[model samples]
Target: MGGGAWKRGGSSCRPTTTAVGEPVVLPTVTVEDVRRVGLPPSTANLQPAGGHVVLNVPVNVYAQAAPVTRQVEVLGFPVTIRATPEAFTWTFGDGGALGPTADPGAPYPAMSTTHTYTRPGTYPITLTTTYSAEYAIAGLPFQPVDGTVDVSAPAATVTAHEGTTVLVR
Candidate 1:
């Protein structure tokens, strides 16, 4: 009897034949541990001052992976991202100025702008940004976000002291 067939007594048994292909029952791979990488942080540290206020606003563009670039439009202002240090400045009405013109370090990507209130009242403060052309990791290029803070001088307090002479004893 040939090796391809099995012989049982005088009867010959044919070899088994099976289709050659991928397995009919294959394992599946499900998505595991999904993580979000690009999402900018909203600005904070908005307070009031004497007819004016200094805002320590933090600006960042969503970037995934290394060297990811993106543009952020704040209040219809377009800001390009060459580096985190380069940021735009926004003033309220007018008569306000920015702080010292020096590198304040990096990693805390933000810009400082002083807003001077012409009168003592409340006003709306807006912040905007525009990313560079290379920046595309984020959603769009123009976005306007704003936060309001009251600007008024501290209320004044006055006191009067009374003194008595020896005749009052």
Candidate 2:
């Protein structure tokens, strides 16, 4: 040795490594609360002599964090009411007898329409609303997320009452 004496069993060599950086947390999507409201109490059992049945559905939808757009449709036996975020249309029977067009006189935040039932019978009417939101993560709009709700008409009983006589048999 030129400078100093070397030790044979003094220390042992070991490998070393290094980390890049801290982990990143990405943003997530969360659906807000949704609500629905209907006009005319959503229940009517009347013995109309003849004519069509007109129903009005007033809907209110809100989102806490993001803006949401939705489509609504009323499903029934003799009729079907369909509405998009921009417009609404009504169809009669199984055919496209009515419309898929927009009505300028319809209400906002709510959709209202008149349905004509050809015959008198009990119908299970359902109003369905679907909501969706558009979001972008990396400068590109991703696929939208959606939600829906279906409301059915209440069961009704119809009977005629005659004057005085108490018909209990």
Candidate 3:
């Protein structure tokens, strides 16, 4: 009880137990607490992960993050929260938008999250990423909060052109 008790400025799991020795689960974090402790999701300088994709093909787009986690004091408990990519919404810049893909999308030919160009042209593609965060306190289990953050990537151009095919007679 002395060494494992949770306290301020501490960063470890300190599980609480009930009178019957059953593990006491922390209540789901309140919506207000999420705003207080979690940093808004960020998609730094959004761009297609791979440049120069073909028309009518799947292109992979992704965001970069370094340990997307945050530590903050909630109410009176020190809490740790981690942000994870939940979905992606893409605007193809051609007056068309594709969206909310659960898959992070693969490269051409293997992309589940992709769009097709109808004409040969240069289009600016914009992507919005939705991030979901979970919180853990006093070594307790992590629980998802009713929090989400959407970050948009700067529009990057992807040129799509038609392939030429001529018959030799």
Best by lDDT: 3
Question: lDDT rank, highest first?
Answer: 3, 2, 1
Q: Count the backbone clashes (under 3 Å) in each candidate.
A: 15, 0, 4
In terms of lDDT, the poorest run of 10 residues in model 2 is: 74-83
Off by over 4 Å in 1: 1-44, 48-85, 91-112, 135-169
The local distance difference test score of model 1 is 0.26
- 41, model 1: CA deviation in Å? 7.4
Q: Candidates' lDDT values, in order? A: 0.26, 0.28, 0.61
Give lDDT: candidate 3, residue 39: 46
Q: Candidate 2 — what's its lDDT?
A: 0.28
Per-residue lDDT of model 1, residues 1-169, tens digit only: 0122211112112232238743322111111100011223223223332223322322221111122233433223243332221232333333342322232222323323333343443444333322111221123332222221121222211111232334653
Local accuracy of candidate 2 as per-residue lDDT tens digits, 1-169: 0132212212212232225544423232222211231211122222232222322211111111212343222121121112123222322332322232233223333333434443444443332223333333333334342443222234332222222334787
lDDT of 3 at 19: 89
Off by over 4 Å in 3: 1-67, 161-163, 166-169
What RMSD value applies to candidate 2? 22.8
Q: Return the TM-score for each candidate structure.
A: 0.25, 0.28, 0.59
Clashing pairs in 3: 13-139, 14-138, 14-139, 56-117
